[model samples]
Target chain A: MESWEILLQQVINGVSLGAMYALLALGFTMVYGIIELINFAHFNIFMVGSFIAMWVMQLMGFTGQSHVLYGLPLTAMLVFVLCVTMVATGVLGALIERFGLRALRGVSGTAPMITTIGLSYILFNVILLGAGADTKNYSNPMPNIRWEFGDAVLHLRELILWGVSLVLMLALHYFVRRTKMGKAMQATAQDQEAARMVGVDVDRVVIITFFIGSALAGAAGVIFGLYYNYTNFGIGYTAGLRAFTAAVLGGIGNIPGAMLGGVLIGLIESLGGQYLAVRWTDVIIFSILVLVLVFRPTGLLGRASPTKS
Target chain B: MPISDAPQTQSQRRPPLLEFNDVNTYYGELHVLKGVNYRVGDGEIVCLLGGNASGKSTTMKTILGIVRPKSGVVTYAGKPIDRLPTAERVRRGIAPVPEARRLFPRMTVLENLEMGAFTRTDTDEIEADKERVFGLFPRVKERLTQLAGTLSGGEQQMVAMGRALMARPKLLCMDEPSMGLSPAFVEQVFDIIQAINKQGTSIFMVEQNANMALSIADYGYVLQTGEVVLQGSAQSLRDNEMVQQAYLGEMKAQ
Candidate 1:
């Protein structure tokens, strides 16, 4: 158990890393599905979510990176903060949709897209001005506990991250496929005019898409913070790009594709960072993105199967 | 030319379910519907006939509130819906079988039908409506689990109609229900449209197949370049030289 099973270790690391990217990628695919906007601000929503979780911990007098609440208390605190952060980020996403993109709905071309980039800057600058340029330590509520298995080790934290991700993703899948509102989202994505003909409030659908997509990003934010132990205004730049690549790698507008793409990219980053020169991680990730786009623009699962959105 | 008793030619035989009064709809600078005024009477199958770019589709869009009238009022069930959004119009007992049968291709036929009743909350009644749709188009029942996109063109049309029926609409607005069907399916579709109209829902259909449309329509309107050039009872229009020449393809061959 003392030996490092490089491959096994890399796979473990990749899954956890991929989990964060998966959550973030969900937001991109959904927003793109419904309104055809990239919502560049979504990356910052994850960053802001991390900061908000940090602040929530701080408000509870748990301010340091060493802030640890174990057993039952830890569970309660994590759940509380996760719920709060998801809501805050969901509302933030909805607000951006309402004021920022609603007016430019039918303006044609990249105006809405450019607005998203502008919105991204606003979110980034707000964090920069409100906090600081320096990387702020995120309070880790869970201790770095490990379980040994043969030559490899499993972190309880990674398992928890993966568990939470799997649940949220399943819930989202059920909602989209089974629930009325979720189907409305899918209907809007396929054909907005047809959706409207059936009496779906397309504008309202747009807002909901932002809410759900951004809320997932918020969860990723908390996970990202817990994994990396710190966050900065610039985290969105690197993390966001990776997640976007993941979304595009899967079908851009596909739900499950984003999740698959996220995990795949996360694994790619981890193994590439370890095996290749650590510096070439970004190049490898983007290279895959370029290859996927060039060869299969629809992503891995973007094939003509059902459940496209 | 046809059965004079197909439907009462009179506009007020029953109360008008939908009315467009001097409504002018614009797509930016292009005025699509020019001061259009029309009505769909309760329980009658009314068809709007026109060629391409003649504002037939825009007329359908205007009634559904997809495109708002720049001026004038659109009334449904005695309420003005000119300013209402498409959702509100649908809520007020209107539904559409849009052109090309725009089904959510990735969804199951059952799911597509469920979506037709998106605005309804009556669980028991929705079930009842589903049964009713299945009864009307029995093939839909067999393909409930199949993805809508996998169905044939004719089957898709059936699902589209079945989906519209799921809403329990008082007024069913259909655009080009016979556009791309084989002659046999076209006949079947017209027969189904009549059957639906007979079941107490009003029909407001826009079609380029004037010959088939006139056969089922109670009343008809002809639009040429965004203006109502001619309108009359189906029998009268079928007998008119202008209608025969322009729409019914009754012109003499060279």
Candidate 2:
């Protein structure tokens, strides 16, 4: 690829990749913000989303041999798949919250954290057993539409992914700031005891937080399947770790900070991988994280005040 | 107002609203509440007065079940509630407005009030109680949509008190309502306390402002080094020589 074309492609790829990271990171950050639990099983939730979508698609009997849904355009089928995946994954997230996370409330910190890791392993193996160890392919009917602007080209899939992520992030911002339930969630995050004292159903708010955060991860998984065109039970770990880095890069608890941090990490990874060696990507990203922590322990944003217990 | 001179009745002989008998609490290995004993009668405004590190707050926490008593029992209305969780305590009509006005910073004043009635099941009753809280603190009504954290210190205190009142508790516990307020705000807080006491909800409060707390409190206990040093009617405690020098400040020489 030419220099200008390469730069353009990297920019597009970086944004979509950043959006995926942001989606997953939003879950990690929100769960951490509310309960102070890292929720290691969250990554497996994303992995499950892909498998759920594939299973649903197969059940629908819309084989890849034909590019139409009930004689409708292939786009509609893809949209249906996306919507179904979002709902299914959202319900799965709620179940995890109700049964898994809720059971561990008020317990010792180490126990829950370790349990989540254990849950992650269990989920990974369950997916392997159900779907087999083979990598699954999801064919996107939306062809790779490339828009050539002078010497640069932009892929349509990248644009769609970035657009959806931005919209989701913006919606999340409004929900947290504008809605009554969102405020309750923030209160619960800040101080669970205080939130309860005010009559906020801290438990309900926490469950809602898990639902929303997990749904976001699930959405990212759908988009990842569309963009990458491949899925496996183990993909969540790599993506989840990267998203975690994004969360830490932005202030962990602050919402907008997560977006900024995610995009920054994306840019570094893509640009660094292109200019420097691909092997140096992790080293560069983590080095930046260490430097940020040493200089500003609170990430880019200032430290959060300790809420009343 | 003149003191009621009516003869004692059978109802008056009933157990107090709240009773703490030799209650002890620990933080890790550090014993905070060392066998603290106290009681508050129905319709009484009782103050737990102490200096810093005297375990006044810990005693309040023990009553609310935020900190489990290592030994002894904390009973509310003759029921052992020492083992109950904080939410269950609130459901049992035991509400606490903690020190430092722990308002949900991101939530609107209205939402905070809604949270106050979390355990309440009746929508109409919850709404009525909210209106009552707004009536008590009209300023909160005006800032119904404003975030709790953005409110002024005195305003936050009002929200905290109103939030507690939403629970409609039989015994309302407050931990140092005047910790960070100005003198005028301090007086305002005490006035609200007295008003709340008059409205039939028993008040059990811990305060650093011993003189002001005793002034409004019907009964008072002086805590020193995690133990109750003295207990009596507010006026008698106010007049006690040790209390006068230690907490109430020395009287002017004639």
Candidate 3:
């Protein structure tokens, strides 16, 4: 490929990678918006989501290629894995909120946040013990096909990645803007006490927020596994940190901000890796984080905190 | 003023819309409300007047179930609500214009009103209620899309009251509605309160301004620290020498 063509291909690749981070960051920001918890365990949930998808694939007798199950194609099996893992991770997120953080509701800020770090360890251990602390190979059922735009090639996985992320983001936007429960969520996120006075089921909103955020994170995990063709217990720590950074960069608690932050981080990482060195990627990204925090503390797109009436 | 001297006796014909029987609430051993008892009859404007740290707001919270009393009972429409959650209490027709308005700052005025009707399933009725709120506060209607936080103090108060009325509650609780408003705005807020009371919603207001509160109230209770010190017809309370000296400031200091 020519230099410009290679840059274009890398840009596409960066966007695809950013879509995954945006998915995870959306969960981080949404949960933070409602409950103000950073939810360190969310990253581990994503890690577990990938492992679950891999095990589900194994159960479906998926090898390196396509297969038919009960007259259903391998694509159908992949869809099944996606649905099951999303639900499983969503339930896991709800369970964490219920048992892990519910009782600690009005406790000091550091208490619940510290509890999440501990919970992250617990989830990491569960995956490590079950999956044997080793990297597991993921099967990509999608046929190897690429569309060439001149000398730049677009992979099927990239299409799936961006398509799923955009669809989910739009669905979330619709849910939060057009629906009743979504309105209630906005009310609760702003003021829990005020929301209760207005007859919003705030406890229900909290649970729903956790479930939706975690489910999105889980979906990101599945995409990560499929796109990269590998899964491990430790992936959560690194990926979770990156996604968390994305959330903060876009403005923690801002939905569209997380998406923008994710894509920006992805592009920065990809372009930085291509131009600078792979080892310098983290340095570049963290530098952006520090600079953003120093200059625009609220974030690139986030407004200053509105004064409560 | 069409003040009722015996609202309790009249309400005895039907159960009081809300009743607090020997309620005691605490904030982690702070002992906020000590054996407090109060009631609001149907369509009555009952005011709870007290100075700062008098457990007046806590009384409102206790009724709303935001702060569960350590002992005693809170019943709404003859059903015990002490064990109910705050949202359930709201669904049971208890809505509060909490201290400082507490409007969802980022949400528009219309969205804030919509939140008030969140527990209701009747869309037609909610639509009617929105129209009713607009009728009550034309200023709020004029700024339906404006963020609640951007409104002036008086306008924010209007939105707050409008938001509560959207719940279509049997009883409306107002905590320090006049806390930060100018004298003119305070009078306007009280007028709106009385107007709302005349519309068949009972008003249970906690206020530091005993004069403004008692002037419109049919009945009044004076809370000192964590206990009810006196209860009477609003006329009697306003006339009493002790009330004038302590709260109304009708007499010059000796």
Top-scoring candidate (lDDT):
1
Cα lDDT, model 1, residue B49? 88
lDDT of the candidates, in the order given? 0.89, 0.80, 0.87
Per-residue CA lDDT of candidate 1, range A1-309, in tens?
A: 343687788899999999999999999999998888888999899999999988998898887666766789988998898999999999999999999999999889999999999998999999999999999987787877898767778888888899989999999999988888999998898888889989999999999999999999999999998888888888888999999999999889999999999999999998998889779999999999899999998899884564422
Give TM-scores of the second chain, every candidate: 0.94, 0.92, 0.93
Please give the DockQ score of every candidate, comma-separated. 0.58, 0.29, 0.69
Cα-lDDT of candidate 2: 0.80
Pairwise DockQ winner, candidates 1 and 2 = 1
- What is the overall TM-score of model 2 with all chains considered together? 0.81
Top candidate (TM-score) = 1
Estimate, for each residue in A156-212, the C-alpha lDDT of model 2 and write its tens digit.
Answer: 777777877888889899998777688778878878777666556677888788888
**Candidate 3: deviation at residue B23, Å?**
1.2
Error of 3 at B186 (Å): 2.0
Interface RMSD to the true structure, each candidate: 3.4, 4.3, 1.8
Q: Report, to 2 decimal places, the DockQ of model 3.
A: 0.69
Off by over 4 Å in 1: A1-4, A303-309, B1-12, B250-254
Residue A52 lDDT in candidate 3 = 89
For residues B22-63, could you state the per-residue lDDT of candidate 3 as single tens digits? 999999979999998787877789999888899998998898
Tens digits of per-residue lDDT for model 2, B1-254: 11222234324433688888898889999988889878888888889988899998788778776689889998888889888777788888988898887887766788778778777778899889988888889899999988777788899999999989988888899999998888898888898888888889999999877788888987788888887877777887887878887776732321
Per-residue error for A228 in candidate 2, Å, reads 0.8
